[model samples]
Target: MSTINTLGPHTPRIALIGECMIELQQRADGSLQQSFGGDTLNAAVYLARELGEGGAVDYVTALGDDSFSDAMCQGWADENIGLGMVQRLPGRLPGLYCIQTDAAGERRFLYWRNEAAVRDCFTTPAAAPILAALPDYDILYFSGITLAVLGAQGREKLLATLIEARQRDARIVFDNNYRPRLWASVEDARVAYRSVLPYVDLALLTVDDEQALFGFADCAAVFAAYEQVGTPEVVLKRGAEACLIRCGGESFEVPAQQVERVVDTTAAGDSFSAAYLASRLKGGSPAEAAEAGHRLASRVIQVPGALIPK
Candidate 1:
């Protein structure tokens, strides 16, 4: 029963922890479109757009003191996303990737990110101060991609921070965005994911990714896995179909809005995760949040890239 306009204040502060990379897209006619994108960064931008001035959204990542990094920071500031915690390492550069779409508009990405500056984000000497400030936020948002990028030692530090943050009453929101290529093997991702599950309050899962990563037979299996990890809210997104929600000991089905044309499916899940979290921060129920998710994702896929123009 929640209308988008009826949503209340979003004063809660959320720190989105991840990387943003330079994005280049190949058009059907062999032209190229340049932009910036990353899973959690997309979520941060969409979350800010949905909340407007209602909430405090900070993007936590490390960038180099290069022109591309400078441009990226300026763009985030233009979107009203906080960059105070972003570290600028000397002589390093941001990551880059290219997107190519099939005839069906389905997308594949080629990354040049193995040497991205963000890989050392949490392990750098400057990271001590940044990690100290994270627990002050009302919510902490991250994804599997964030984990993969942080590497093992950095992830250990992050896991400790997540535990401390939750102990201080901050809610943890996680998205299961499994990019297999980012990790050495599926077992590595499984270990990283398991280490963080017990502290998660809300988990946004993509059914296809879960099936590919964890071999979850269905939504039921996904729900069961999270429940065992003590996650109270679980939202499942199945592309083009209804999303499933399990919260407060009850489950609900929220259908996605039908789009006339699907230009590109990139960032569909990222946008949905943002809207859903924004709805929750505004005090909407899980069912209502799922509806908000679908509303935003429906609008996103109709556009050509991971980020749609505001």
Candidate 2:
């Protein structure tokens, strides 16, 4: 079943909308490994890696005209992700964050993003043109974090954009990468999520986050809620367990590849979402896409950060 109608006979273009931050991964000896990462950005990178020439991918976000921002652009370019939709806001700066991991490689983050340029991504002067162009893409992908970063005005703009995009037959894909600290309150986050869920065609969800955010009693409840919203395809990822997928009125299960030692689970879910979307874009069935998702995410967690080396 096709999710998106391609703009034309050209390659399918998917735009991932979110932020990229300066990431500092803390080591045991007090050393820090620095890089650039964000939920949708991580998905952008991996999706690009997965699709190389199979499709086209673009990252839509706002960044400062700073050196770090320059480096981030350069890095994205190296991965062949499109920068045409990026906004370079003068006098603003990209946000920064540090990651700390427990012995089991579970990670926690400390953010310095209150003033990040991306907070006004859809509110900036350049945003009007970008928003105008966004609806033309074959697919529009974003995350819960994307919603959180965009303030009230930006969220309204984004909500309108999503509606317009879908009206043009662009498929909407959403990943539930919820971070409690990002929103003003649980209620605010819930409102933002509900505003967008009805437009989503495919939902990549984390079981626990759904439980926490919507108080979903269990996996069944989560699926019922998404089904009620009429999300045609839903993939539920329960870390280290078999992922469940319901698409085209059928259900499937894909077992994740086991890792002996989980190094860092930073981008596990993001990477999974990327590979799954890439697979679908490349004509794989929902079941095959889930397999691709598990394959990539298995490799991601064995690495030290959100992104593994190409």
Q: Which candidate gets the maximum TM-score versus the true structure?
A: 2
TM-score of 2: 0.97
lDDT (Cα, tens digit) per residue for candidate 1, span 236-301: 999899999888778889999998888899999999999998887777777888899999999999
Q: In model 1, how many backbone clashes occur? A: 0
Model 2 residue pairs with clashes: none
Off by over 4 Å in 1: 1-10
What is candidate 1's local distance difference test score? 0.89
Clashing pairs in 1: none
At residue 308, what lDDT does model 2 achieve?
A: 98
TM-score for each model? 0.96, 0.97
Tell me the TM-score of model 1. 0.96
* lDDT of the candidates, in the order given: 0.89, 0.92
lDDT of 2 by residue, 36-70 (tens): 99999999999999989978899999999999999
lDDT, model 2: 0.92
Scored against the true structure, residue 48 in model 1 reaches a CA lDDT of: 98
